[model samples]
Target chain A: MATVNWRTINIDALDPDSPANFDLSTLTATVAPVSTADVQSLAGQIRQLLRGGDNEGALQGALENPPYGADERGKDVHLATVIEILQSIRQSDMSPMLGRIYKSPGGTEALDVLMKYIYKGMSQTNAASTTRNITPQATGFSQIHSRGGGEGGGQAMSVLLSWHEKVVEIAGPGCIVRVMTDRRTV
Target chain B: MGPPEVHHLFHHPIADHSFSADRQTLAVARENNVDLYQRAGGKFQLKDELTGHDKTVTGVDIAPNTGKIVTCSQDRNAYVWEPSPQGWKPTLVLLRINRAATCVRWAPSETKFAVGSGARLIPVCYFEEEDNWWVSKHLKKPIRSTITTVAWHPNSVLLAAGSTDGHARVFSSFVKGVDSRPEPSAWGERLPFNTVCGEFLNNTAGWVHSVAFSPSGNALAFAAHDSSLTVVYPSAPEQPPRAVISISTQLLPFKSLVWSSESEIIAAGFDCEAYRLQGSEQSWQLAGSLESKGRPGVQDHREESALNMFKQMDLKGKVTDDTKLKTVHQNTISTIRVFEAGAGTVRKISTSGVDGRVVIWTL
Candidate 1:
């Protein structure tokens, strides 16, 4: 008698990637797609607000409507605007800004959107550092840090990390879980 | 309340479990087989095993009115087990799908059942008297990914399905011959077969793990992978829902949830412990964990001897032994079902987990 080890076989590899097998429409956002021009205009407005020292307005504008249905380029533009707004806020004003965002109508959802951008910013910075291939200085007690970063990149990472910490402190850990599990792109 | 009653079965994950209407027999889906345990002297003894599926059994449900058992497996097949004098006889269901069946639930009327599958469709199977076999009609439209879990409405016509596409949808599985015209409700009127009554996406578009209809069939609740439970109350047919309340928890995501009543829901999953959420259709909040921690004598059971402390420090480089969690279930809970109900409210509930322990909690 002969028996085949069906479990060990790569069944998924054998199957063709067809629409009937996996529907792509379900994975995409149901919202209408955002055009590149619209994203650019929004980025310009957010940049103007940032320059005017309206950090809260800029952050709120960046988070109010995520480019859920945008293409990769459009989403990247929106993400860059969000990071610029996140970086413009003073360290002391971070808690108060988050508190105001949390207290406002639909503030919790805005915070969740902000969290998604924060994670995206962190990953992009990390990726840039890796591509640059900057060697770490072998200082005592700091060699234990595994993430590679240059001096400028490390400061940016610290800012993002502190924002992440404070976001979790205000929004609770659910924001992190939401950002990690959410499939809809920012 | 007192501590929950726990029975540690064999060391294997139980994907799903169901109790008979009389609550005398318990059926659990273990690895390739469905094991039946008889309730004897306040303990469950292994009675028999229904072994037919070649792959892992994903779901098992026992019909309440009729003592029939329905089991679906990852082998892309389903079986309806009928008790006979000789033994339990298994009848294969013609699912007509090429992918694994992930979950199964018998309709309240016991005339039909729905199987959620990786084929991105739900096959509503009903017995054909003339052919003397179980035939299925697929609900294919609007379903995008593998269905994770399915639930039947109290009327037996409406079915709710949760899928990996981050959607919980309510579809009419009204088989023309098997099911009668259901009464008009918030879901819809003149329910035809494959009618899309409602579709709800999770807040962050997380994969929905479990979806359930309320006891009254007027509301729907689903647990998603983002550690949130959302409850939707349909206002009127073709209109927006009156309320879609999502309660996010700090704990791990819930894999299974059951409505104890119209106002209360008990959910358990990766948290290893069950939690209770209570409120109305307008708003809801997490009440707390069902487990009452720091029970008397539980703390005393841990031995803090110097030798044990030294052994712990030498082995794991830690002074305290934190291997054991405070919760009863040592691993992720996979399923939660109502064990006993009275007067439209669940009195006791049962939960099984990866720890191979079945616990009964009085709510």
Candidate 2:
């Protein structure tokens, strides 16, 4: 699986005052080894290097880099968890306020963010929370993680994930594990 | 107390037929003319003829909750209908899909829609958002070798797509257009485990002519070319397929199927036989068969003699290809649908085809 650089886009990039501007960012974890402390660290530093459109490195340093390792077959188990979380969230009726979602007038930014998360990797913990929430966003069973990217036309939209499912935990929002195939067959 | 048994509801057949959300109106497919019908006075009356399809019409659908009518065709286009004071009018011509479409279906909420085709060059399109308007996003590649059919979850953002290779795939009807800010109206299908909320279901005995999901979106029934009906549970991939029953009696195959709202009742059309699965008594005999309204049994002796007379024509040494396997019937079922009238119980179903005639039955 490809490792996602959690620090490529600054979490601070969003407006500090508006929760809408809050960035789901972390420290210079992209190039470091992950430990419980690395996972919990509040300060993040970005080591800038071109991987591909904000898609590179890991936020937390871990000997394992991407804790999920370089395995592809594990995607289905991860996907199954996604379904479970979605079902749980869908059954309930809670809608958490997402203070900050990339706002493209259309839906690409939100789309891209979701893709980036999928690409980055989904945290089993974060995923479980989203899945368990009974809010409209979690349970409606028909959500478009969309934004027009402020306007429309052509804008890049992607979802990355931090597979925090019991089976595997991925990283960031726009990062995808090269080996994992959640986009298909899952 | 059988005051009057409503035999069945008859639906008009053009090519593609879709039901409205509240199950009120139905739209029939026509190459250049799409017909909208009001269910009450008659099974299907010409409410209006929608134009814009430049070539043969391939598919038609009505939104589940709003009764918005959407149509797709060889013209490489799709149109969405909205309610107007005058009547249901074509409100949006949104965007044109590049591939010639074979089928179209709406998400349960009418918030999203899908279009599929046989052409591999073009991936299926599932449109959810347009900037200041609605725009379409697409699956990057063909889910199957040759896309043939697509159906959406009646109440959720899930999709069931069929391809010529006899495979059907279910996928997360992921909403499109995600920006940095959090979403307000997202209600997409959720996954239980690592598995996609959707899965690939049964392949048909032969090319599938049509597929229909129950009103509740609980079960899916598809009829194949061999006149066999395959009913499956789309959500439970863990369970084995429940049934793959054959609707014997037709040699050519079935063209369409429509399911009733309250029961497992399914009405299907074969060459000459219109078979339906009625009554949910929880028994195998729950299935009831309906013979063709006008099947010409074996031609009478005189007509047979006349046909034989024509067969008598011969160039003494003339070559002959395959002869008739069975006597050809004049009527072939081309389309089928089930809908509701104003009164909840007065449900209607109908069929039409080669005869170019329409028949309506009420339940």
Best by TM-score: 1
lDDT of 2 by residue, A31-145 (tens): 2233433322311211221122221121211111222321343433333332222222221121220111212231222222233233333343344434444354454553333
Identify the candidate with maximal lDDT: 1
**Using alpha carbons, what is the TM-score of model 2?**
0.47
Model 1, span A43-105: residue lDDT tens: 999889888989999999889989898999999999888887877788899999999998898
**Interface RMSD, every prediction, one decimal place:** 2.2, 22.7
Give candidate 1's error at residue B123 in angstroms.
Answer: 1.7
lDDT of 2 at A27: 9
Question: DockQ (Cα-based) per candidate?
Answer: 0.44, 0.01
Query: Cα lDDT of model 1 overall?
Result: 0.90
* Alpha-carbon deviation at B341 in model 1, angstroms: 0.9
What 10-residue stretch in candidate 1 chain B is worst by lDDT?
B295-304
Model 1, docking class: acceptable
